[model samples]
Target: MALQSLQITALTAMRARDVSRPSREQQEAADRRPLRDETPRRDQPHRGRDR
Candidate 1:
């Protein structure tokens, strides 16, 4: 049927998108890259007296 064919086409397109999505390795590689706009900030120690 025409409707069935249309559904199959839509499903195939969706599957293609899912397959092209980045894998865990690609995501890790991207995360390791530094962003151009910011620098890492150091955490400051507490100044108040504490035993």
Candidate 2:
């Protein structure tokens, strides 16, 4: 039936959408990770502090 086919198509689309989306845990883990510029800072001269 047309309605059944439409339902199946919708379900398939939903499944595909879910598969493409990251899980909440993955998102949280990403949030906890270090940023791109994150690096160990060594004692360095600061021009502002020199003022």
Candidate 3:
């Protein structure tokens, strides 16, 4: 049998994480931010053959 003190239910775990986090809106904004450092430059068009 599991010990009472060691037991952790899913709802309590979820609530702990939710409470420790910053305001919900700011947390959401940070999560949405991009991970990539820089985007690759698009290839430049080449000059057409001289007439």
Give TM per candidate.
0.44, 0.41, 0.35
Which scores better on TM-score, 1 or 2?
Answer: 1
Tens-digit lDDT string for candidate 3 (1-51)? 467569778999999998887998997997788656655666876678453
Q: Which of the two candidates, 2 or 3, achieves a greater lDDT against the reference?
A: 2
Pairs that clash in candidate 1: none
Per TM-score, the best of the predicted structures is 1
Q: What ordering of candidates by TM-score runs from best to worst?
A: 1, 2, 3
The lDDT values for all models are 0.82, 0.85, 0.80
The lDDT of model 3 is: 0.80
Lowest lDDT sum, 10 consecutive residues, model 1, at: 42-51
Q: In candidate 1, how many Å is residue 25 off?
A: 1.0
What TM-score does model 3 achieve against the real structure?
0.35
Candidate ordering by lDDT (highest first): 2, 1, 3
lDDT of 3 at 25: 93
RMSD of every candidate to native, in Å, equals 10.7, 10.6, 11.5
